[model samples]
Target chain A: MLEPGQIADLTEQLDTDDAVAIIEDLEEHEQKAVLAEMEPEERAAVESALTYEEETAGRIMQRDMVAVPEHMNIGDLIDYLRKNDDLPTEFWEIYVVDPAHRPVGTCQLSWILRAARDIAVSDVMKREQTLIPVDMDQEEVALRFQKYNLISAAVVNEDGRLIGMITVDDILHIVEDEASEDVLLLSGAGEGDINEPIRDSYKARVRWLVANLATALVASFVISIFGGAIEQMVALAILMPIVASIGGNAGTQTMAVSVRALAMNELTRSNTRRIIGREFRIALLNGGTIAVLVGIGTALVFSNPMLGGVIAVAMLINIVIAGFAGIFVPVMLDRMDQDPALASSVFVTMITDTMGFLAFLSLAVGSGLVSF
Target chain B: MLEPGQIADLTEQLDTDDAVAIIEDLEEHEQKAVLAEMEPEERAAVESALTYEEETAGRIMQRDMVAVPEHMNIGDLIDYLRKNDDLPTEFWEIYVVDPAHRPVGTCQLSWILRAARDIAVSDVMKREQTLIPVDMDQEEVALRFQKYNLISAAVVNEDGRLIGMITVDDILHIVEDEASEDVLLLSGAGEGDINEPIRDSYKARVRWLVANLATALVASFVISIFGGAIEQMVALAILMPIVASIGGNAGTQTMAVSVRALAMNELTRSNTRRIIGREFRIALLNGGTIAVLVGIGTALVFSNPMLGGVIAVAMLINIVIAGFAGIFVPVMLDRMDQDPALASSVFVTMITDTMGFLAFLSLAVGSGLVSF
Candidate 1:
């Protein structure tokens, strides 16, 4: 993945469909050259695959699969398998099809081998099998595989005819890909692959920074409102970021957990409220602990007991607020039919930062810890 | 996984080895009850397995695999499989063992079914099959399965005797578990399961915040040193967090990419320098774009061109420093044999915050922008 030239080298030697998958990852000009050098049939296969949407099962599935008609007996199936030299190199099961070429059932090799050779293929085949549609998104395909514990599933066209098969190996990659994608998207990094081109990396990352700039101004505007209080006590300026930074971190912790749980199907409508309550209590406990520690450190360093007391209460308040923002932002996004991880950081940080500044400065001014 | 009572109910109906796995996830007291309720032989097996370390193959494998001596012909193997009422309900391959019961090779069911019944198992077996060590870590097992595209692999003891088999279904869970773990750990959140008990969630998340408290003080200490400058020009306080927040975000973006690449085995000794160079150039471009936007925003809002110039310089310097810390911290941790994702946020944020404060304040003081 690091060397483009090496990728081009590897793709040329692989099976045509497999080569197409690798070549699709290359830059456009590199892809053209790789495609042009292929045999016409192979090139046609590759070019047709490129027409499918990115991240669809059509683009990721292997074209090589073993399929036989349902009327064949176990003996005939075995004879055909032995006589054919071009069967797929690896296959755990054979798809049983009808005259119309639609897959009717699947026959695992174990059952076929164990059965008497004279037994009809349809007699031993499993009729209830999962079928993947051609244009199905890869993420949903992975979920179906996970749910059914499928080792291999038949892919069907709109007419319900088998086209290709998706193996467990492909689903493994999709699961990891989707999981890491969520983590990166939450951080506002696009695709976040180390092998990503420099221009693409910059384009993906800088736009998020620009969005952060817009949201950070909201915090700045809040700070500008409290400028008078800050000028009177430089210690407030020193301590303000402590409140915001810790709050931001706490919110991120909650958000990471929430986003992950949603992805795993562990946090759903049936359990969301209960989980939120659990987080709230944990936040209170964490907030109280940090408050006492920060409070003692602040009083000793600044020699101001009242100021320490004010900031301690503010810390507790801000952390609790952070806990709410963390879980709420992602949950709301999910309910709105949006990706739970999309720019969650930007919104959660906005809440925590605003609340942190508001709570600390307002508490100090209200308590007469600082007077202009 | 959500309720102990539900787990107890589910485990009671499963195979003894499977029951043991579910019981092991419970508290010690709960484990005792579950084990006590089991049949004597089942309890003994579960007890022996519990002695092995968590996340090891010993604790997770099914003990009901089909193991046949290498001399058995395909006909006899099929007959033995049919006669055995208690063989594993699901398996893709049959282990071919030597006289001493050590695995010599594997015969995929597909191969056996396709071969003549009179052929010996050894003739049809693949001798180069992957064998998993009994006490191997689950993560290592997953990597092997992924690398070889295995449907199933044999587990062998230290004495080279076959003990059990790990199927692809088990590896699927481990891959998802390990991937989610990295995301959670990077956020300083423990386990991060919504189904995890409230007490457990608190224990995992609070310690990191306390550590954040300690690291955050370093930024505060830096701020206190420049209290005079902040008191003289309060705009410094209003604009300071924008620098730190944006820098922290950029560090997170780069760190997320680097950490994920390392996890995926995409970043390594061969390409580390090239990747670093790529990131450096991207950082410079990102920094320059952000600097221009922030500089213009500050000059217009604050009505102070010199202060704007100072902060723009600080933002650029801090963003570039963030890029270095982002990649360097995780790579160094990887070299030291530590998890690159473990508390990386704490270290990376520490660098960006400290630098954000230092750069903005020192540059202001040096450039006479503060009027102190």
Candidate 2:
């Protein structure tokens, strides 16, 4: 084998997956050279999986298993087992297949070890078995594993033939990836992977920032229409952002809930109306509580009761719009086959900010509370 | 044996674990009653797991297994398995264990079927086998299963005694649950299970809204100070919100990234500096671009190039602050052992809004851009 230093040198030149693959193809000397070359973190990740395939059954399954076949004498089975290797390694059951490499049934290792071995494999194997399709999406695969509480199941291909098997380990990665993806999408950040190149990260984040700017411009244009009112009443300028800020926050909270529900398959056609109704009620309750507090505070700060009333009314109206827009925006996007989370925050912010300004300024102008 | 209908009924009233336990306890009629009461969903969940314990090996494992003792004549082993009634229906290997129920070795089904049964178990059973601890966290459990590519594994208690077994199915659920939990926590939402009660939904959402309200008030208070500037120049009021909205959105984008990174264990002390540096660079690039567009728009709308220049500088400064606060606030909170995701959003919003208003308003006053 190559010396440790040589291995470390080689490992530094390759990514973890490639290094592992190359090592597998090399002689013991070369393998050692590459492994020793790897950093501790890379080595650990690679060495931990050296025995399994890069993408196949062996790599994804535990080596611990209990196996037996169609025929055995109970006494002979026990005596043979007692005098031999230990029992109950990593295994859920024993497989019984036909002579041509086709699985017919299975028996639990517990049942076999606890029972007399005189029984034939056919006698113990359960006739009914749920076979997994190997190429299934990992999320769907995990779902099956969850629903079934399967310890280990047979993996089969399109021909109804057993191929290599997928175990719980492979599905775990799928679950984590899918969940993280949803979160990143919700924020309009492209798949937020730390390992992603700097260029990719820049490209993803900049586009969203630009979009937000565009929406902010729309809000600014709306504010321009109210320039006269603000010039007349200084308080209007100071208090206006409060309305937008409260509305934007309320919208974000509601949007978060809706997006999560949609992802979990919880908010569907049947429940949409009910969920919306519930959110509305909650919004009113939330708005009223905050309106009282902020209203009183505004009155005290500005010493203008009428100004406080206007702010209070604006807060209530904005919160209501926030709740509605939060659910409706995502749902509409989903219906259009767009990712519900994609650019949703931008749209929601636009609605809340625009409405916050329009309502507060309009109310001020309409009431003649501040004369231009 | 219980009828399918009865088994279905019983499963409806119990959680998967409880149902399995009662299945072991029920009289034939009662078992049938419980199964009959189960709806399709409940029945499917329980029936699929009839062989395993709730959390133990039995609940999560398939009952199919293969086994042979150490002493069996190879020929006799073959013959005996062909006639057995209690053997597992199917399995990948046969376990060889001691009288004390400790596993020592294994034999693959392929080797057994191909080899002469006259060979002794000692000659064929593999000595290397990985043992699994039963009480391991599901994520850890899934990792082991993936690392090992295990089809079936024996589950053991603290004493190293085999308690039950685990399979890919159980690990699948663990993976999904862990992933979903991270996603929900990032959004400050409770486990967003649809089945969760409405009251819980209410409690989970209201606190964040209130926190957001408090932050919104800070922004409002900032505006109040700029009342004189607004009273002098209507354009200042018109443009102030644009600055705040852009900064808020940019800050949110960065906050989402930081929170997600922290949750995934990707952003640790070692990488914190690198991550922060990257976000700051992106913020500057984004801030520059948005400033140019907004500045031009402001100049055109207000018919004053000087006003546009002042606001543009303010926009650039506020956005950079937003980015800094976004990454730093979460990192600091995480160090203090508070949930970074839960409170970061509110804090970031406050920073962006307050800074946006302050920067824009102060710049206008200092630059003499507003004429009373």
CA lDDT of each candidate? 0.86, 0.69
Minimum summed lDDT over a 10-residue window in model 1 chain A is located at A1-10
CA error at residue A221 for candidate 2, angstroms: 2.4
Task: Judging by lDDT against the true structure, name the best candidate.
Answer: 1
Error of 1 at B30 (Å): 4.5
Q: For model 1, how does the per-residue alpha-carbon lDDT over A247-332 read when each residue is reduced to its tens digit? A: 99899999999999888777889988898898899899989989999999899988998888988998999999989998999999
Interface RMSD values, listed in order for every candidate: 1.7, 5.8
Chain B, candidate 1: TM? 0.88
- Per-candidate DockQ values are 0.65, 0.29
- Each candidate: how many clashes? 0, 110
lDDT at residue A359 of model 2 (Cα atoms):
89
Model 2: residues >4 Å from true position, as ranges? A1-141, A150-166, B1-178
lDDT of predicted model 2: 0.69
